[model samples]
Target: MRKHLAFAGFATALLMLAPPAVASADKPEPRVSGSMSGTLPKEFGPWAGEPVKFTIDAHGRPAGVKGTFKVFHDRIDGSKPVGDFEGKITCLAVAGEVAVATGVITKGYVNILDKPTEDVTGKKVSFTVHDNGRDDRIFWIWEFMGAPVNDCQGTAPAFKPARGDFTIRG
Candidate 1:
């Protein structure tokens, strides 16, 4: 029958040029933690007991930093806490560093007056620290006054910390 209809038209043109099979869908990776407090700029008194804990991965940059600062005796009568710090944080961002922090005060500051002793360390001092993710809101910049200010600022929810931390990582 004409070579079996040309072999069924070449097997229906090789099943219409074959090629059709796909199944793929998987994408989800981005996590961040939170928790922060501010107020601790008496010129860092002198390491104010050794306060400087940081950790930002996910891409933020900074990866890890320990803690410990001390330097009392500068109470102009503000009461206390002239220099109190804390620590704790994790990282995971690569290439230069993106942003990823866990928790624990990033930067601190306290000196409104009414009893604000007077530890302007060196000068430049601002507060408003706290950022969990998506742009929490941070803005601390304790420069000169004590030297070694860590800056921070966000938008979503809140993440602010820029007044003194010395930021340093690799």
Candidate 2:
């Protein structure tokens, strides 16, 4: 029918004249990535002698990632296993070369603790990366401790790693 053809042509022309869909500027830019493996200083808590390792590659925000984050710990002297935990990266706020991330511990285990799964799992955790290259420092690792710990809602103290290298990008 001529009427149908005319309507199709008009719709096509209107669509062609419409403005293109632009990317949203409100969305967060790709940022925040860190990987490190070393021993936490004795100042943290009892698990100072253990070797800990973790990796965080958070790009966007809460809704983007499913697993959130992961942390690994191993016993080097063949004694007992170190503490390990994981959860989703709920929040990541970056400033300059330092980035602070927060999430909940869904599951974990620590040799020192009697019940790491029940103690650490379901609790909140935070990690700070001061990406200064070989001299880079870890601001805080709030998950390993028990109660009365710093949440790192804003900033946490920076402690130099005793060993291992760090590759943090912000």
Each model's total of backbone clashes: 52, 2
At residue 134, give the lDDT of candidate 2. Answer: 74
lDDT of 1 at 1: 100
Compose the digit string of candidate 1's lDDT tens values, residues 15-82: 89987754322422333333333333555444233333223322233433322222222244445544
Assess candidate 1 and give its lDDT: 0.35
Q: Model 2, range 1-170, lDDT digits (tens) per residue?
A: 99999999999999999999864677455356656667766775766666777776665533453225677777657665666677767776667777777777777755665644434777777777777767877654554564433433645536676555544333
lDDT of 2: 0.64
What local lDDT score does residue 27 receive in model 1, on the 0 to 100 scale? 23
For every candidate in turn, the CA RMSD to the true structure comes to: 16.9, 12.6
Q: What C-alpha lDDT values do all the predictions have?
A: 0.35, 0.64
* Residue-level lDDT for 156 in candidate 2: 55
Q: What local lDDT score does residue 42 receive in model 2, on the 0 to 100 scale? A: 76
